[model samples]
Target chain A: MIEVKDLVRQFKSGDRTIKPVNGVSFELGKGQLASIVGKSGSGKSTLLSLLGALDKPTSGDVVVDGVSLAGLPDGKLTEYRRRDIGFVFQQFNLIPNLSAVDNVMLPMEFADVRKSARAQRAKELLEQVQLDPEKHSRRTNRLSGGEQQRVAIARALANEPKLILADEPTGNLDEQTGEHIIELLSSLSRDHDTTILVVTHDRGLARKADRRFRLHQGQLNEDVTAGR
Target chain B: MSVLARSVGNAFRNKIRTAAVVAVLAVAIGLALSMLVANQAVGAKVQELNASVGTTLTVNPAGGQGFEGGGEPLTAAEAATAAAVPNITSVVGTKALRLRTETTTTDTADAAAGAAQPDAGGPGGQAASVTTSLTAAVDAGTLGNRNNTGSGTGTGTTNGTEPARTFTLPITATGTAAEVDSSGKALDITSGTGLGDYSAASTKALVGTTLAEKNNLKVGSTFTIAGKTYTVAGIFDAGTTFGNNAVYLTLAEAQALAETPGELSSMVVTVNSMENVDSTKTALQAALGASKADVTQGQRNLETAVSSLNSVKGISLVAYIAALATAGLIILLIMVMLVRERRREIGVLKAIGARNRTIGLQFVLEALVLVALGSVVGAAIASFASGGIASALVSSNSSTAAGATGQRGPGGGPGGPFGGATQLLTSVTASASPGVIAAGIAAVFAVAIIGALVPALLTARIRPIEVLRGE
Candidate 1:
């Protein structure tokens, strides 16, 4: 359900114009659990940002569900992000002052979900992500790193977006917690028919995805048989 | 999770800081409200003065200012001519008279001359002394006896064997062509009514409270003036001891008593407005002839008092503006700081698909909540403090003017024809009316909205991608 055609995103660093995402091309079918592995500064997150429509491309286009993001207005792109795409970050960027349930309910509120339904939906999403019910009422800052990551995952699923983007989702966790988070994402994609793309530096995590892509020198190449 | 709920929650994110901001804003808003109240009170007083004493013109006989100046008294025909002048509202003629008890001999004419001069520059100039059987209410003290004895030594002893003789005070009496006194001010009657008809000669007189009390006279009591028995028609409180030691008679009776028929001591001409005072004075003079009459604008003391009141009005207006600005600045600075501190939250909200308008509205709603709290406290402070602040401002400014003009009287000095314009200046009362206070709070809210919007707009410049990437 995603298509990238020669997508290029450029920026000026003093006298040089650097292309973090350059001439990239790829495709992923619906419900596909995919991973993009790269060394530090290899532009793995940049490619994910392009697919998420969080940033515009300098050339070519990113098509998701047959809709081209190339020249879409900022408002329409924000709407696409709010209604059809969700993001999880390495830092688990949950608002520190809000409780875990409130963090999950935020995106639903932005989507204009009915106020009465948001709390119940948020609680169910938190339970689906394996967060304990008691910890759901605690502030995100007071939770452990693994718990915060679980809350972030619940927040991303709030609006039931078709695609999810995870940038270094396990970068701050221990090996065991990181493996559990990856398994949780894989299960969400398989059970809910949701497309998932995780950008990471861990090859072991990358190998667990149905499709594995290696990003080097601003280019992407997929591994045809990874999960099997 | 509504924007309103989030904004309300954010308002109290830092309880101590919120309290501090509200306290500071309350002080600034309170000061602004106080100045606004003072400004309104002074403005009303100015309008009152302009309507009452400010718009009057006095016409005296040419050179009839002092006791020795020689000129023919103003005639009824001249008064009528003045009344016909353009912009002249009404003209009230007055005849000044002084009455002495029959027991007090005129052996001391100099004392009578001093008594004939008005203690507080009445519209009617110098009074002509007349003998009457009515006794004066006030006792002639040492100075009075010294002036009456005609002896520089002031012992009242022409010879060593003669005991000091007692002298009775002379009573100042004015005959008015209207119910008002010579100053064109309505008498504050304490009991009974005014002289029924000013045009006709009647045996009815309005007695001063002090004079009536001293003579054991009440309304309907009888007294004799120039061998003609007159009934006490009214007792009036003139607001001053000197003003209360007098009586009022009809113009015709006073003129006949002075043996000067068809003559008037002076004419108090009311004009339509103070702006027309100078023009009306010129017109009245031209109509009555420069040689026949001299027309002067209201009281000199009134001019000084008005100048001081104008200063008060100006100062209060400026202070009000300054305080309002300070309040606005406080809100602006506090909002800017909040926006800066919450940049991360703004970025996260934007990333979560919150619109720019939603974020801006949140900050504005938060600001309005703070302003509402401040206004409640500020209004309470103003309700209690406005009157005292206004009184202090008027007193200081008017006293400065009075000192600069050196017009404070040692003995009930020369306070224009309306008792004392200086007294009017000191009596200005400032009240914190609800309407005025509400209007002031509305102004503060308006400023606060503008103050909040500036910082809220700054949120638009924050890019979620940039903030997240940096983090």
Candidate 2:
């Protein structure tokens, strides 16, 4: 579950203050999938960052699973990310020199998982994302774009976090693969009871989420799609 | 998936960059390690030599270094001041003068044979006479188990006229046993004994090898100097003709003979170590005044040799520092580039909940790996190459120059104290052991960590959101 009220993120830009997320508020239930759509510079990513406990906002009260994210210390925020949330980026951002499986196992390593268990879990996660065992051993740089995105998704699942934040996860993939990734995320939200939020420019993907919110000029407008 | 595994994997991400940095570090650390070994080796050799011979300051009348100065000779009081100076363990003072000998063949048969010879005044009963001059001193001869008598030499002469041709012999009348020991000029006695157990006050004498052999004089044979008879008690090998013709007696006899009851021509002050030589000389000068005494340290030639060799030591030390710094710079530069290249990956890790230390640790580990490899390769190369390089750096010309200096003496006067024995160093070989290698590795590891840490700390400040935004 997530709750945000009056969140504001302002940055200094050459004597001018730019508020990317200003007085935005939202809430989403557990096991729900949601989408935040916005034009470039509309602060969708900034709000997501605040909700993910990745950055401090100028003013905010964000609660995920009853834990306040705003103003939390760095250590506790990192703990929240490590134990409760997973992130997927538009670029996939897999560690380039590492094999797909190694990339997938990275988060688990941060969690202190043993080497053998990390390897096993990474392989299973890769398989769950339809990546071949052969592909799991390939360096992320050598993988196909879709395969790299799949690896990123598998890595996101490595720690089995309660929430997944997909930042344009399918942005660089072919349309068909992007659709598949969206379905995969939706399936995880429904079956595993994991909440999911995707920030994307893809309207087709956004429409498929359980809830949709459009961000404009640092303000949020909700479009309820749950129970559709 | 482990931090070290990930770091190692990242180390080779840019093969060219990795190899370039590694190559630079290997050479830099290699040069550094080699210099370290060379400095240590040369320093050790010099220390040993210095410890063995120690140091001796020659405090002479201020004006002349040799026997040519015009200043008044040091008085007994002045010499005492020299002895009392800090670092001066013992002082031996001397008063030298030319001793001209008058000889006559007492053997009537040899005289008849000499008279029958054309070179003998054609049997005109021209009692053939020869005159030889020597510099006799009241300074004690070095004659003890303590190289307090480090290395010195003396000279005398023997005429072929068996009946007795007057040959001038340089004689030293020693005042005390310790003074004699501090002379370091004491010859190794080949026959008989040491001036009678190092201390009996007698008008007895010791003859050099050449003098003993030439006149057929044995331990009990008597010789006359200043018209006083002295029984020979020993024959000593002085290693050179100049040294082998010398003689020793009690200081009272030589002063009575020289007629200078309380004057010192020169003073030798023994010091404990070479490090103390300069200070001892300074103190003696301060005590006696600059115009009163010209202080000369023992083994001037060897000191010169070591001085020349010390330049290489200096350069190598500088090189070691520069190399270490350059290695650090190289790591810092490479890590900066690496951090730039891996900015995205760092963000991803951070977003996945990696702590600042975790990310920094990976870079530190990577830098350490490169440094570790460099140390092994550098040390291995230095172990084989340093000996030759060090030898090459130590100019053989300096050693020869030192030899020439040692070989030089008043070919006709006493060889003085330390003959050619001051040839202390020729070549030095670095004897690096496993412990040395281990120390080198430890140093390199530290250098690597410091080099990586600066950039790694920057990584800690990276914001994941900004990195993702930039992408």
Off by over 4 Å in 1: B63-71, B75-181, B186-265, B271-291, B294-298, B373-396, B410-436
lDDT of 1 by residue, B370-407 (tens): 88889999998999999999999988886677667767
Local error of candidate 1 at residue B228 (angstroms): 12
DockQ class, candidate 1: acceptable
Query: Model 1 interface RMSD, in angstroms?
Result: 1.3
Task: Kindly list the per-residue Cα lDDT of model 2 for residues B309-421, writing each as its tens digit.
Answer: 57667867787778888888988988888899888778878999899999999999999888877887788787887777667656463445455655445663213354432
TM-score of each: 0.77, 0.71
Each candidate's interface RMSD (Å, one decimal) is 1.3, 1.2
TM-score of chain B of each: 0.74, 0.57
Tell me, per candidate, how large a share of the native contacts it keeps.
Answer: 0.41, 0.78
Error in Å for residue A197 of model 1 = 2.5
Q: Model 2 RMSD to the real structure? A: 9.9
